[model samples]
Target: MSDKRSFIYMALVLSLITIATRATNNMVTTTLAPLGKYVFGFDNLLAGIIDAVVFLSTFISTSYINPTLQSSSRKKAFISANLIIFVLLGIFYLSNAVIIWIITGIAGIAFGLILPNLISSASLVDDKRTAERLLSLYSTSLSISLIIGPSLESYVLSMFGYKSVFLAFLPLGALAFGLSWYVKFPEVKRETHGMSAIKNKGFISSVLSITTYNVPFAALTAFLTIYAIEKFGVPKDLAYFSYIPFFTISFLTRLSMTIRPFNSLRYPLLISILITLIGLTGMVLSPSFYSFLIFMAILGIR
Candidate 1:
């Protein structure tokens, strides 16, 4: 019982860290349009480049850093990654356009460093059911942060302005960084890798399937606030909260998955893709704010 309790505690901490890191990352996307235009005097092209560079950096970092994360001390590496993010975010607030790119790029790398360790730590639970539940809760925690983080960004932008908003969230980052040092991570196992895994058709298909679902999801997250404002003439606050339907449904869907694990992944994936297509079509043809939100909710069912 004591060991199980400790594992649960570790899972919770890992979930909290996931929330902090992802929320911080989302805050960038949420504010990207306004911040780029208002603060940096950038046009869409420049803003897109700045935003794209973060994910590009993540890709580069993941290819190299993920294996290292798998091999190293998860606790120490996780703490260090958070520290790097904390430091870079602070610098990001003080930076100009070129400098902001540099800061955000490095922050993006740190963001990439977070996930493998978090999921690996959760997987340390000995029982398969418990581990699966923790992973679901872990995903749900991310949705909660998505709901909260942009809302907080909207609030801060409304009350404090852009730079102040970044400064305001620093304390939360500090808190996550401080609390991370106390969590106990499981022992690392050496990872085996080969081209053989990639050669498997099932492996390739699974990756493509996830990417298919994720591309639209990623686009929605990155641009939803701007899309809402431009399409509906809504205030930033309203635009930010427009995502509530999508994330709320997503959280509930993931919660349901935890309670009832998928019996077969293929059929569900197909159904989800169909639903997502309907949602995308609805968004393109949406006539009102409510309709678009309804579409977003539909999309979140996946």
Candidate 2:
């Protein structure tokens, strides 16, 4: 196949696997909450801490997590993220212990490895403009997965055992492995421009804003399900399923704004910040299941 054809095919595969894994993250929190309580005997505060720690670790890892140099190295880093998730997921199936934190750390390491490469890989797959759209499609997959992940997870938990949901992700991980073989990740391009902010306002404020947004984002990823499971005491399945509505609403909102016949790159960065703030408020005050669902949906939109 031609390179263009390969790019398209790879984009589709990336979307499918990414959505599957992301959904697993959103939905699993609730199921694990009860397990943490009854099986591992954790209090709400402690469970929240466990949830918080994962993102905290992810934040720390982000700085160090560059894609490996060789194509094989990059592929290994990419697939290994899913592979690690697969293993930890299996561990979750067997035991509900403090080990989940270790698992979360492993998952975070995988996330760090996988996500940056997607950004870099997008540039390689096509020209810059096309790359953004491709990455957006990739993002869309996760959005769809976010929407579907919760619902699918919820269904699996309700229909089968909670343990089954963990198993559901293995296929996604395997698919990632299969697709990794086909990814002809082009050479890493070098930007001629240096990282100097010629038009910066203040050094301190820039640093503050850059770091602050990640706090809530990380916090939400870590604690949203825990909030639903522990604070609201929603059933594990229902909590897991909540991701569906969240993703659906958010994705629709994005599609509406983005997929117009006209091509517009207006105020996305500003809009994102506003959306995030709004979503963060919803998440923090999300005491009931409905509220958590709303917040997650808003987060998805943002």
Worst 10 residues of 1 by lDDT: 188-197
- For model 1, what is the error of residue 215's alpha carbon versus the real structure, in angstroms, after optimal superposition? 1.4
Best by TM-score: 1
Evaluate model 2: give its lDDT: 0.64
Model 1 TM-score (2 dp):
0.87
TM-score of 2: 0.75
Q: Per-prediction RMSD in angstroms?
A: 2.6, 4.6
Model 2: CA > 4 A from native: 25-34, 67-72, 96-98, 126-132, 189-214, 229-233, 260-301
lDDT, candidate 2, 28-141, per-residue tens: 544555456655778877766766656556555444444224566667667766677667777777765756767767766666666555555555643677677777887677
- TM per candidate: 0.87, 0.75
Backbone N/Cα/C clashes per model = 0, 1
The lDDT of model 1 is 0.74
Off by over 4 Å in 1: 69-75, 184-197
Top candidate on lDDT is 1
